[model samples]
Target chain A: MTTKFTPDHEYIRVEGSTGIVGITPYAQEQLGDIVFVELPAVGKALKKGDEAAVVESVKAASEIYAPVTGTIVEVNSLLTNEPGLVNSDPEAAGWMFKIAISDASELDTLLDADGYAELTL
Target chain B: MAEVPTEDLKHTPLYERHVTAGGRIVPFGGYALPVQYPTGIMTEHKWTRDNAGLFDVSHMGPGFLTLNTPSGDAETDHAAIAAIIEPLICGDIAGLKPGQIRYTLLLNESGGALDDLMVARSKTPGTLFIVVNAGTKEGDFARIAAAAGNKATLKRADDNALLALQGPEAVNVMAALVPPAADLGFMQFGEFDWNGTPVTISRSGYTGEDGFEILAPAHMSVALWDELLTDPRVRPIGLGARDSLRLEAGLPLYGHDLDETVSPIEADLGFAVSKRRREAADFPGAQRILAERDGKLSRKRVGLLVEGAPAREGAEILDALGTAIGVVTSGGFAPSLGKAIALGFVSPEHTAIGTKLQVSVRGRSQPAEVVPTPFVPHRYFRKSV
Candidate 1:
């Protein structure tokens, strides 16, 4: 599955009407060793670019932004005991939540891998 | 851009190296040191815990105190100088053998700690080498100088640079550079040469591991650091890991764990006070210190393991009923323990191990328990060959 990334480092993988949302590899690298992750509850609705979750490191905490308007369908429950998964595999197994897309057309607004890399650089 | 007061921010010789290594420089103890590398604080902290980490602590004050005499015969009166200096601190300075190092505290007239420092008795009889906190070094020097008053001379070794190589593999990595250093026991120091540069190496470190603190000439620090980095076992660690490592080892940072207002007795640093000094009562704060040592101290420093989120400095410590009882002096998430821990000053009544308490962090009261320090077991090397 192709994953699109946002300028702010959030990534989204569209699967029909649902999307798998997580932070990008670059974001995880920058955030360092993840100690805790606070995922939004299932069924919670979020607007595009709204604060969706929280990821904490040893030294600081950061807010995760929603890439598109959606309702949370699933949250990564493993994060409570093994937040380091976000650092180890931010792109794959470290996916934060799955969302039921409210606006599939909004996916066009996000950046592809190349564009995300350029923005990061 | 308008200029602000940055004169207080001192830079070490390796400041540029830090920037190039992707270190996040921050002002600490009046010096600009790397708080974290590009990997970030958590990564650096975990790396240091699991593997060897190099630290650039060159900004700390490294100096010597020379015993002075009317006839310019320092060796003749070396014992007197060591004895005189001992009164101002709570270490067995007079009993320190040649090439011995001891962690000690500088006390005020009220028995409060002015600063906690490391003093090393060099091979030279009249010279006592010392390393003090960068922020309080000037004041510590002035206090010592004034107290010594012509009995000893305070000489700042500004040409030297300090580096800490810490973690379980630190000894092996450093041993490759200084072969004989591998056998040196903890708290023992000696002069050695690293690639033709004379260096003073101490088998002691803030991290709860077997490590060495190498003090070399400022010009050679960068070269040594680069050379150490070439080894796969050693990775450059920033100040962020250094702080967490020391905190996990239960070591106290100067301004946080100790201050001019907190006495050695109150800080639970009584081990530093020798029995001889206690009996003599000749030190500056001997009278009050002795009283506190005899169970008269009102407050005592203790460690706390907190539940929930991390508790930061200045967090209010509360009783079981949520009443304010004390304040956290230093608190943070301990990476190794995978939990939050804190050091705080509580009433002596609440200082016992396992005493239950609560800490208020971010407007929430979290349960905490009084625990013994070195929150993690210290892994200092004590073997002598």
Candidate 2:
């Protein structure tokens, strides 16, 4: 139940064949306030590195990329009402979606906690 | 292929403090200012609305003006200075009692606004303190100097730094530092000493709140800022929250809402032009401004509650039938109102509140309606002593 982070600040925690994906705390901190979260629709297929969501802050807008290829199964509905959760707990409670992994091998491309921290620094 | 140095971006004196507080620094008005801190802009914004927020407005220009004549008498200097500057602005400078402040606009000969500034007649006799925008200060000074024509002396207060302590709880935090600040009503300024350093504190702010703006010597600014942050009610806010706060208040930013091509009458700021000044018709563009006031204006500034998505600056505003009517001067998602709002100058025919309109953003037309300003009501303190 450990999450892997991408150098770009996305986190992927695998649960069986499906993985929950969201941005890391570092990413949310850099983005400032999260005003809007444009999540991918359920059942939409995504490729590794493909844009999965758009997070708009008061200062800027950035695209959230998929860390592993899969089809989106569920999205975080809570973001619509309280986007600040992303800043509050970006990797855990702020997970954007659950995706059925189409290619488990894509997980190798992401970094572990230590590697992600180094990349951010 | 060359990497730019971090110093290439401008930094204010409190840059280190912002970074230490986990603030996200961003380029704004040519300086690297904190946009928000770790708590995030929304929380920071809401916190300011409910509590108190300290803003580093040091980049703003604070300067003084005095009569050019060497009369050596404060009373004579005050009369000469007021008379000389009154004809150039829309406000009744002569009527400005000591310690009184007035918001006025500098106009071009063609009836366009050069800049909107705050002018405060000092209680120390003969001195008028003015605050102008950071981005447009240089041009504003040049224009003011040229208009003064050796009749007044304009001295830029480079040694001073400005800070805004805003929100409902601002008075509580500031009252501890300067006891008399709680008694001053909105738009009123007075001199006080903080730890032996003289300061000018005004009960006015860009945010629609009961707050105070403090101007002190640059060296003393950091000390005062540190002292204020000790209060649990006061947290440092950055430019991000500042923008949303002002937007919710529906205040016009100089370059965006009021510009060289926009006249006061057309910008819905005719109130700033007093009846005496209007009748005198001696200020620059007075004739054209008065004509516009008399219903001769073709376009007028109006507020818009945009539907669909946020329409940003330069977005084209359209009439009900889809014809271009105006352009959005300032538009954003108002954190306080929880909706997208915009300010623009639509044709006079379409300026009525509730008038249906459309705004084109990124090639998409979104429905909008003309609305009144200050998306949020101003909560300035009014002491009934």
Candidate 3:
């Protein structure tokens, strides 16, 4: 039920074995405008720190790394039509995908809200 | 992106202003410049298209090319000076009229573009203003200066600062500060005295939208920039929007779209090779350039409307059978077009408008179609008189 963060600037909102993942607001702010988001397909197995998705801005493109090892169960296809939504509401509606957590212990390796806020600062 | 080494980077006159205005400073062309302001590049780009955007372009090499010997008759002196510079570039410099500007390319002996630049003829006849790319300025100046010998003197105006005010509302803003600036037709420039310092303003810019470029003394430029921004119609822009604007305009950037290995003909800049220069075949690289004019080039620059992910620079362009035909030189989302668009090179056979192709983005082939460029129409001011 708590949100955890990674040093690479991804967030995982834990919900049982399924978790929703997205990039942090700090990452989006640094990225400027989000012109395109290339996400992994559903059922794609991803390892922790693996290249999970891509976020492209008007200036350049950056890789979005996975925070924990899991398999993508659902993707936020809404990003295709409205990429700017990530800039507007990166935390909620801009969530990139849902992953079926393969290992609960991997969540411990990530930072909590307090730790993430400090890391961003 | 890799940070440009801090040791070699320089700062412009407006460097402090950019920091004060919440600009995301980055190293570009060996200068510390703002890539975008707090409003972001997309907003700034739209502002320039609909209203006005002010850009700091002091990093560009803006200097004067004047005759070392002053002949009493200004007309005669200018033609002679133009002749000295004409031999070094592909443009017809001798045919330029007073207050006119011509876009041309400095070429290598093998017909490749050294750098694309703008040459502006001053009304004073013996003098001409030259603007070159920041990255190539040092070498370009040295080359031109060495070639000038005693006939002309190439004065490197590092003390000057350049700014571009672009948009549909650009004229309205410039007219308020200096009325004569609005009267200038596209590709024309004139000097005006405002307050105490003189400012050279030209009805030319990189954006496809109508605009004016102002050249002023380095010390006086900050004041002029402040004065222009006081107008409610104008917003400060950064280099991020500048690249997108020019790309949409179908303008070739020196280092990216053009380089020492790419010829002007292959880059789709044949118009810059003047009518007289074509017939005379007298300018540098004219022999190979003229030969390429009639003959088929191996590849050509073309615009693409990408259907999927934005195809970026260096993406491989593919033909119908998934064969790599060419590579993209500059590609990104066109803010005005509201779709992903790209500029890439392809075999001549695949360059026709509406020709279908594919671009490999992240190892997946995406659908692309060749389209007529300037992805947007240019709106330059043309005087009736």
Candidate 4:
């Protein structure tokens, strides 16, 4: 399994043909408190940079874009009631959705954990 | 055009204090102010609703309008200064009782709002202290100086710092700091000293909860702030929670909810125009503003109980037929109400409470209803018998 990050601050944990997607801690910190989340429905196909979801804090709402092209296989329905999970555990239990990776070679373009951390700094 | 550096942003007296306390500083109204602390906006907001929250509002305009030449008599000097201000704003300043604070709107010639401000009579001869929005203060000050600067000296107390101690436990915290402030009821201001620091406090605040706004010399703010936080009931709040608090209180924020094109009547701030001024209609834009007071307004500001996503500014307000009727000025999740509530302007026909409407949130229509403001009931402190 390999965890990759995009410059826009989204992360994807890749395992074979599937990948789990979520935002990085740095992004969550900038968002302050998360009050609402709207995710794309399953079977929706997204292109890289497409606005895939929306996360709202008390101050304002922001869009989360797709890092790689794929179809959404599953979503974190739990976020509908408890959006604070994004602030609590953004990378683990707070993962937004699972993407069925259409292009495995696209993972090579992403930054590793250390690379992303350095990029943020 | 060259980009402005963050270093160019002004810092308040509480900047270092906020940094030491782990506050997340953001650019706001030409100042680098804290948006939240390490505990985050949610915790800080909830804490304020339950306890006292101390806020640094030094970036706002805090100044006094005094009679350029006092008659040495309190009544005569006050009347003289009030007469000068009466022409610029829609308030009956001349009729204001000493030591009283009145929330009023500065008007344009078209009866539109220039800014909303709080004017407090200092109870002393020739003094009326006022506070205006941070972003508009420069323009507001210029206009005030031009309109009545000669007749009534406009003293921008830029050297002073302002703070707001808010929430249910605010009075308790304030009383511990200054005993005299405890006797103050709602909207009453008094000058006092704290550890020899000249301070003016009023039982008035932007939050719907009971609280007070204190102003003192800039050099004295840090000492006073540090001392206030020594009490467990008082925690430092940020501008993030402050916005939510005022929004929940249904108080319109200038530049967003109010502007040059919006009138006091259309913004639902009719009460800010004093009852005496309403009949006389002597202030600026009286012909149009007073004419609209009879309920013939084209649009009216109202509250909304949003069912789904939070509707932000510029969101479209639509009728049942998917026709746009109005636009949202301010909208957010009300922490106290535990739901998304918004303030917006709609046509007069849709102004009635319980009138069903749909707010287009990011192009998705969300069910909403016209509700009475404030989203959270105001708990202002009133004197006990």
TM-score of each: 0.82, 0.86, 0.98, 0.97
Backbone clash count, each prediction separately: 1, 0, 0, 0
lDDT of 4 by residue, A3-121 (tens): 99988889999978989999999999888889999999999999877999999999899888887899999999999999999999999989999999988888888899999989878
**lDDT by residue (tens digit), candidate 4, B1-385:** 1124669889998899999999888889999899899888888889999999999999999888877789898888988888877788998887777778889999999999999998878888888988898999999899887877577778898668899999999989888999899789898898998998889898898989999999988888999999999999999999999999999999999998899998999999998888888888888888889878887699999999999789999999999789999999999988887789888999999999999999999889999999999888999988743
* Candidate 2 wrongly placed segments (more than 4 Å): A1-21, A40-52, A65-75, A97-116, B1-6, B9-11, B70-76, B319-324, B360-367, B383-385
Please give the interface root mean square deviation for model 1, in Å.
4.6
lDDT, candidate 4, residue A35? 93
Candidate 3 lDDT score at position B342: 88
lDDT per residue (tens digit) for residues B259-324 in model 2: 888999999999999888887788889888889999999889899999845777899999999999
Q: Model 2, B7: alpha-carbon shift in Å?
A: 0.7
- The Cα error of candidate 3 at residue B268, in Å, is 0.4
lDDT of 1 by residue, B1-385 (tens): 1124545787888888998998867788778887788877766777777778999888788888877763445445557668667867878787777788888888888877888899988877788889888888888888778867878888887557899998888888977999987778998888898888889899888888888999988898899989999998788888777888888888888888789889888888888888777777777688888889889988888999999667778999999998898999888778888998889989888988999999996577989999998999988887653
Candidate 1 CAPRI-style tier: acceptable
Q: Is candidate 2 or candidate 4 better by lDDT?
A: 4
lDDT of each: 0.83, 0.84, 0.89, 0.89
Interface RMSD of each: 4.6, 4.0, 1.4, 3.9
Evaluated against the true structure, the overall lDDT of model 3 is: 0.89
| Residue B90 alpha-carbon offset, candidate 1, angstroms | 2.3
Clashing pairs in 3: none
